[model samples]
Target: MPSPRLPEASFPLHLPHVWSGSEMGAQEGICAPSTHACLDAQLPGNGWPVGGVVEVLQAQPEDHVWRLLLPALGQAVQAHAGPVVLINAPREPFGPGLKAHGLPAERLLSIHADKPSARVWATEQALRCADVAAVLAWLPQVKSAELRRLHLASHQQERMFFVFRPLHVQADASPARLRVMVEGHEALKVHILKRRGPPLASPVLLAAQTGRLAELLQARKGRAAPPQAALPVKPITPTPSLAHLATAAIKGPAPGQQKIKEESNVERIASALDRIALPG
Candidate 1:
């Protein structure tokens, strides 16, 4: 005899952790919504996975790290009320820029490590900290084994973790649960390299800047720049040589000699004034 079939509605689709290969998987643990609507839609669990390393591959270290992760980091700061730790950042974090993105400087903890080992070590230690809500590390020279170690450490903790590596490293195997490649300047073209579900056919375009920062940039681009004022050009007068002065003196007083001297004095005074008026 044939067994009774399960109802379609009775399928385990309702479970938060279960999803088919055709569909994106859902995260059983807590997730931080990546502020980007298109990116979040493509991400598993509709947001960043909290218990795993998210490998971000880019041509340059500082290309789209802020543009892509600012929103999620800002949210993490607010929700977890913990500092976002950064290891081996290429440049010092600009406090004003962070504030413009709604992420206060006080909420960030930056660790400068020159060596790759130090950087990986710092990231692992940061993940273990209870007060850290997120950890972003730049480990260009880090090996796959180090990454796996970091991933395992992150998996034990419930926090957002991101490791940025060179774009060439994508060809190598990684232990990260999610992987993405960031490109473009004005707008980010994010290619989901590896995920729990099917591969993305096209890249997701995300705004490089948003909020007041974007508004200001847009306004500047839209407005026509004012014309620059032209500087006044003064005709240069040749200075009298010592020989010429001697000749003039030897010739004695001629017609309107005093008047000529007075005119020359006025010219010298006007030239001095012009020098003072012009900017350096």
Candidate 2:
């Protein structure tokens, strides 16, 4: 009988290091401090407390409360590589503003719901989805029990969730781990309404320009340093004369004035302005 063809040898495959149960258990549910020192002070760990709900409240429409939220959301989008869901029920979120704030426009998925209840429902569903890294909902108002359900969902899915409430609900004791009132300005201030590990009295200032938290120690040090001399000021430019403004306001030309041809419009305007010279 002909000798059987020799079988080709197969090489064993090598797998990279995989964490054991013990190793994973040690790291499980541990909160790491955020890169920003100020944020870490208010939050449980360094950054935003994982598996917890944070509420962003605005006193008025023009307060720009969303500025306080963008840093954390931007961080999440970068770190997780997961889609961010924005649930808009009251008003449409400014997409361009979000993009300017450094959130990837393509990674944002916006959902517009007709009612507050529906908005809440959609937000809860999105939070449960594994594809989403974070869910930001602009909720009008909600019951404490309803919020608790969302909190449970967040924990179960291990996702970061934020609820933006327009007004403070005194009757409802929010079950969220962090209840923050964000007032917007050049620097956004975050008041810790409630927290678990630390006292809630401390107010944290989040620099809107930089995502860094404002450190009290650093501020104290800055105050101790000698102040610098003020720079020389420049004079303000004078406003244009009313007659010149009136001439400029004429859309095409004054009532009896002939319309200048498009080709020589620049020369014609210069001639007319020179003819009726106004004080600078």
Give me the candidate number with maximum TM-score: 1
Which candidate achieves the best lDDT against the true structure?
1
Task: Show how many residue pairs clash in every candidate, following the order shown.
Answer: 0, 3
lDDT of predicted model 1: 0.69
TM-score of each: 0.69, 0.57
True-structure RMSD for candidate 1: 24.5
The TM-score that candidate 2 achieves is 0.57
